[model samples]
Each structure stands twice: as structure tokens, then as C-alpha cells.
Target: MDLIADILLAAGALGAGIYCLVLGRRLNRFNDLEKGVGGAVAVLSAQVDDLTKTLSSAQNTAAGSAQTLTDLTQRAEEMSRKLEFQMASLHDIPDTPAREATATPAAPVSAQTTSEPMFVRHRAAEAHQ
Candidate 1:
């Protein structure tokens, strides 16, 4: 009976050792740097970093564009106000001015007419002189 018990104990120990060896190999593969969960985690981390940088740059560009648009809007409003003032002033002016009464009667214009129209062109250099 003692010899049989000792043999059974030895067999159990051998089986446990084999099981431990297989589990250790599986754990090593699961945590491998390449073709494993660890590799996927590493790739995802790099992608996150890249996306963060891109988002920051996009925000900066948007801020600059907003500032430029604000400046342009202010300039447009100022120009609109000036134009309104000019239009209001235009309303104050009369369409026709009062002509002074002449003592002598005006002569009638000639009835002569021409079929062809005439045009005059002046040179820039001659006009200055």
C-alpha cells in the first residue's frame, strides 16, 4: 500500500508540472510585443498621440480665422456707416439750382444737323502740357 501511494503522488506532481509549463507558454504569447495584445495596445497609443496633435493644430487655425473674420466684419460695419452718412447728405442737396434772371432775351440755336457723329481723343502728354 505505501509503494502504491508514493507512485500515485509522483504521477500527480508530474502532471501539475506539465500543466504549469503549458500555462506559462500561453501567458508569454498573450503578452508578446508583436502579433499580440501588447502590439495592438502600442499601435493604438501612437494613433491617439497623433490625433491629439492634429486636433490642437486645427483649433489654432480656427482661432486665427475667427479673429480675421471679426476684423473684416468691423471694417465692413464702419464702411456701411460712412455710406449711410453720405447718402443722408445727398438727400439735403437740391436737384436743380436757382438760375439768375437774365435781362436780355436768349438767341435761338442753329437748325443745322450732321449725320455722322464725331469723337475727339487727347494724348496724355499733350494734356499735361
Candidate 2:
């Protein structure tokens, strides 16, 4: 009976050792960096870091664009105000063709220049008015 008990105990120990060896190999595969959960975690972490940098750069670019647009808007408003003032002054003046004709008397011509006769140009303009 003693011999049988010892043999049984040895067999149990051998079975336990085999089970432990198999479990250790499975655990090593689960933790492998190249083809396991560890590899997936590493890839995900790198992607997250890259996304964070991209988001930061995008925000900076937007802020710069906003500042530039604000400056352009202010400059446009100033130019518009100046143009409005000029238009108002023009509205106050009379639209008189005779006043323009008489303001500076025509210079006496010797009738030698043939490029264009001044009186003919003046007549055509007066016809338009």
C-alpha cells in the first residue's frame, strides 16, 4: 500500500508541472510585444500622441487666422469711412458743365496742331451734357 501511495503522489506532481509549463507559455504569448495585446496598446498610444499634436497645431493656425481677419476688417472700415466722406463732399457740389467751361478760359490757339481741335472736343462734351 505504501508503494502504491508514493507512485500516485509522483504522478500528481508530474501532471501539475506539465500544467504549469503550458500556462507559462500562454502567459508569455499574451504579453508578447510584437503579436499580442501589448503590441496593440503600444500602437494605440502612439496614435493618440500624434492626434494630440495635430489638434494643437490646428488651434494655433486658427488663432492666427482670426487675428489677421480682425486687422483686415478694421482697415476696410477705415477706408470705407474715407470714401463716404469724399462722396458726401461730391454731393454738395453743383453738377455744372458751364462752370467747368468758364473756370479756365481756353488758351488762344494758332491752329497749327492737328492732333485734335480743342473746340471740337468741347462741343462734343457739351452735347453729352
Candidate 3:
């Protein structure tokens, strides 16, 4: 009976030792995993910071572009108004002299009939024809 008890006790001790070894190894692995995760978090934080900076720069650029576009639009509108004003002013000019000039007639052919030479008479006759 004593020999059997000693053997049982030794077997239990061996099992407990094995369990502790495995548990310690597992604990070490968990610690290593924790360190790896911490490193990854740091890297991610740096990446986020970089992304934030890039976003800010992009926003600033967009604001500047919007301002430039606004200025260009205002200039275009001003130019359009000036063109409209010039066109309106042109419509106010009088056409009376133009109409009178177009209405006036040449001298009568009978008045210059004798003084005109042969070529002029020929042209006049051609025009009359």
C-alpha cells in the first residue's frame, strides 16, 4: 500500500509540473502577443496622424481654389455687365444721317449730257440700259 501511494503521488507531481510549464509558456506567448499588438497600435496612430495632416492640407487647398473661383466668377459677371452697357449705348446712336445719305440721288443725266465724254456716255448708256 505504501509503494502504491508513493507512485500515485509522483504521478500527480509530474502532471502538475507539466501543466505549470505549459501555462508559463502560454503566458509568455500572451505577453509577446501583447507587445506585438502595442507596436501595431503605435504604427496605426502614426498613420492616422499622417492622414489627418493630409486631410487638413487638402481642405486648405480646396478653400483657396474656391476663393479663386469666386473671384473669377465675379470678374466674369462684371465683364458681362460692361458688355451689356456698351451694347445698350450702341443702340442709342441716331441713324438719321445714314438714312439721308442713302436717300440722296445722283445728278440728272440730261444736265451733264454734253460735257461728258464718250466713255462716260457709254457707261451712262449702259447704266440706263
Task: Please provide, for model 1 over 1-120, each residue's C-alpha lDDT reduced to its tens digit, 9 standing for 90 to 100.
Answer: 999999999999999999999999998888788987988888999999999999999999999999999999999999999999999999986554446225444434342255544555
**Alpha-carbon lDDT of model 3:** 0.84
lDDT of 2: 0.88
Local error of candidate 1 at residue 79 (angstroms): 1.4
Q: To one decimal, what is the Cα RMSD in angstroms of model 2 from the true structure?
A: 11.2
Q: How accurate is candidate 1 locally (lDDT)?
A: 0.84
Q: Write the per-residue lDDT of candidate 3 for residues 7-65, one digit (tens) a residue.
A: 99999999999999999887676556347555667778899999999999999999999
Ranking by lDDT, best first?
2, 1, 3
User: Which 10 successive residues of model 1 have the least lDDT summed?
Assistant: 103-112
Identify the runs in model 2 with alpha carbons over 4 angstroms from their true place: 1-23, 97-129
Strongest candidate by TM-score: 1
* TM-score against native, each model: 0.60, 0.58, 0.48
Encode model 2's per-residue lDDT on 67-125: one tens digit a residue.
Answer: 99999999999999999999999997656687775897654555545576555446787
lDDT per model, in order? 0.84, 0.88, 0.84
Q: What's the CA error at residue 129 for candidate 2, in Å?
A: 31
The superposed Cα distance between candidate 2 and the true structure at residue 102, in angstroms, equals 4.3
| Best-matching candidate per lDDT | 2
Model 2 CA lDDT for position 48: 99
